[model samples]
Target: MQYVQRADRKIVGYEETEYDQNRRNSRDQGKKKFSRTMALILGVVLTLELMIMGAMLFHIDFHSADRIAMVFAFAVLYFGVVAGLTDK
Candidate 1:
């Protein structure tokens, strides 16, 4: 966290601001594992994603626009959300 100290409140002559760097930044927070909730979500999402991939890969009537739409929806919704899933 960063904090700035302003001593002068003048409208025309603004003094320099002091910043504190002792606190850690928000981005430097500790690691976050794939929680149980996320795991459950991943399981369901992965199952459907794999099924779609199999259908598309094996050329098993995966030509429908609906199928393509399913793929796009998964990418837009779940896959990106699970991108932070880590083994450790």
Candidate 2:
């Protein structure tokens, strides 16, 4: 079977072989899986950040809270951007 696609205002037509289809599907699936994994990791990291912040609020050992918070914030921001791009 064949399909048509539009790119850069140009019309293109191509036929995908069985092997090509499987390869494409696997690559797409891998992106989805990686996005999910990143989401889970982001969630865990955020949770740790909250816990650490809460500990500092409760007057616990959080002398390095500033450094840790920055790390978690950047991690979440980076992963969030990656997830958003992959989902679309």
Which has the greatest TM-score?
1
Model 1 root mean square deviation, Cα atoms:
11.1
- Which runs in model 1 stand beyond 4 Å of their true positions? 1-24, 61-86
lDDT of candidate 2 over 1-88, digit per residue (tens): 5656677777676788899999989988865444666666766666677767766788756565587776787678666655664464
TM-score, model 1 to reference: 0.35
Error of 1 at 18 (Å): 9.6
* TM-score of every prediction relative to native: 0.35, 0.30
Colliding pairs, model 2:
none
lDDT of 1 by residue, 1-88 (tens): 2244566753353443343232334345554566867776876777687767877787766565477786776666555445545344
How far residue 66's Cα lies from its native spot in candidate 1, in Å, is 25
- After superposition on all C-alphas, the RMSD of every candidate to the true structure, in Å, is 11.1, 9.1
lDDT at residue 12 of model 2 (Cα atoms):
72
Error of 2 at 45 (Å): 3.9
